[model samples]
Target: MAGKLQVGLLFGGKSVEHEISLRSARNVYQHLDRSYFNPVLIGITKKGNWHLLEDIDQSIDSAPPLNLSLGHSRHTFPTVDQQGGTGLLDVIFPVLHGTDGEDGSIQGMLQSVNIPFAGSGVLGSSVAMDKLISKQLLKDAGIPTSKFIDLTGQDISKVSYEQIENILGLPFMVKPISLGSSVGISKVSSEQEYLKAIEESLQYDQGLLAEQYISGRELECAILGNTVPRASDPGEIIVSSKYEFYTYDAKYKDPHAVEIKVPAVLDHLIVEQIKDLSLRAYKVLRCEDFARVDLFLKDNQTIYINEINTIPGFTNSSMFPSLWAQHGISYSELITKILHLATERFESKKQLTRDYSGN
Candidate 1:
């Protein structure tokens, strides 16, 4: 207890994926190695408030408030820690997903305060969070992402359905620019569905993207490490015929709607290819520590990048953990490894000269 690092598990955010965050936090809290790390559960309300929770599954109430400062995070101990404690968070594993949690806002805040946290930094988080921006970068980098058209803001009104259909083809995907968990996404074939899809997507974000839909198998690759990142065994997702695509409902609302196959069955060559492309995409996107890259493999064996999840789900059954587990790494080991990566990154940054003096 004297030498253990206090790890903050931040979860629940002002994002639509709040519930998913809660689920992820619970699993992380359960798997956290108590011998080496002191787990501090922190929850955020929908209205954007942080509460230090005594219990992992505590509801939003008048819990002891938590505040963050330079270098370390500080919180009250009288009520927040009934175990009687006073210490700074050595590192934070933000178990939050989507919007404010994954889209660089929280990352930027943490970085500004000099707080060491897990997952990608501000740039990587922001770059990967925006669908259109990330696709454009991928195209520039010659990464194999699917064809997409920017329908953001007035651009959506400027592009006609006929133009979009001509470019993206009959069955296209309309998606929000800054969201995960498959929220505000739709596959459009008809003009009516396309029009309605625009409105539906705009509900979650002001920007939108129309991408070419490939009739193919979906694959995911989990990434870990800092200086030199590594891609986990490729995983596959089998969407039920009941759903046109992997929708938010299919992702969370109904668990059985999709089958997840870790270390997806593939030829040695194909598996190597998936690993290569996944690593390339992860590097091009500037992702750090850990992330999950989604890709589509067409029947012809062509692979196209779908999107990247900077702060991917961490539930027991999530692909990130499952993929690593398939490689013989347990869930607790993965968590410990990620914390080590964060501390390593922080220490490296601390040695860099932050100020300049005339010599």
Candidate 2:
């Protein structure tokens, strides 16, 4: 490759979904087109250590987070690239799934250094990560989402399972407020399940989301773009009878646990409605680059917004890339387009800044 852009492929994090991140990163790395770009593998360990891999197959090791000196000039690291000397990175493509990576931490770090990266910015990342906040905003925007209440501090201590059963009803979903990959999520239909669910959820986050369980088909829509985002044909997740819901095991552990149908079978009008709702939810969250919006389609032809993933999974079986593939964009083409979008957004922002010296 000659004069190719260096893409820093980042993945892994200090989150419950660390293993899932690794799978996504590896898939993304493999699918990345080497002709147009040179992949710089930057894997982070579960303990939050950043490593510059010599090759794609390099394993992660433990260390502390990078200590950067934020001076006046642009912050640049030495010997971080593949070559011995300093080489400017064109863009960073993060496959990190949850917590520090997806929840605005990494986004903020990139933004602080004025580096171009794929996916949503800090505000969108943080808002979409917390289910409690997202539900409120979606409801305010007139988007139909299941009713839910946040349990934090006094609410966490005072609220009882009986109260939730009465308010939302039996068979509600209990989730860690800011997590993904179905980690620390439980569909509770009993007091026993509720207690265990909350305790398990608290292990992941200080807050919990007790959402009403809407009985419907599970659908997901993958969105792409910044100003005028487009939604892919909706996909359906059919969880087998073995699992009560799409649990972590159903998502990653057991391949036979669920069936995923891209461009999910539906009427033409229903597909349009799903696309409209997904776009609305994406814009409401101020999502940029791309995201995956989940929804619940009730039998009455009504739909409810579930949640949005800012940095969705890029694994071989992930619905995001799979949904776009149906639209004729292969895995390599989709990522290449995403990186171009990242650079485009970065350049546009830089031009928008006029030296405000007169005023």
TM-score quality measure for candidate 1: 0.94
lDDT of 2 by residue, 105-184 (tens): 99998887777899999999999998988999999999999989788757977888888888998789999899888888
lDDT of 2 at 325: 96
lDDT for position 24 in model 2: 87
Candidate 2 residue pairs that clash:
none
Count of steric clashes across candidates, in order: 0, 0
Angstrom error of the Cα, residue 352, model 1: value is: 0.6
Model 2: per-residue Cα lDDT at residue 294: 97
- Measured on C-alpha atoms, candidate 2 has an lDDT of 0.86
- Determine which window of 10 residues in candidate 2 has minimal summed lDDT: 75-84
Query: Model 1: runs farther than 4 Å from truth?
Result: 69-87
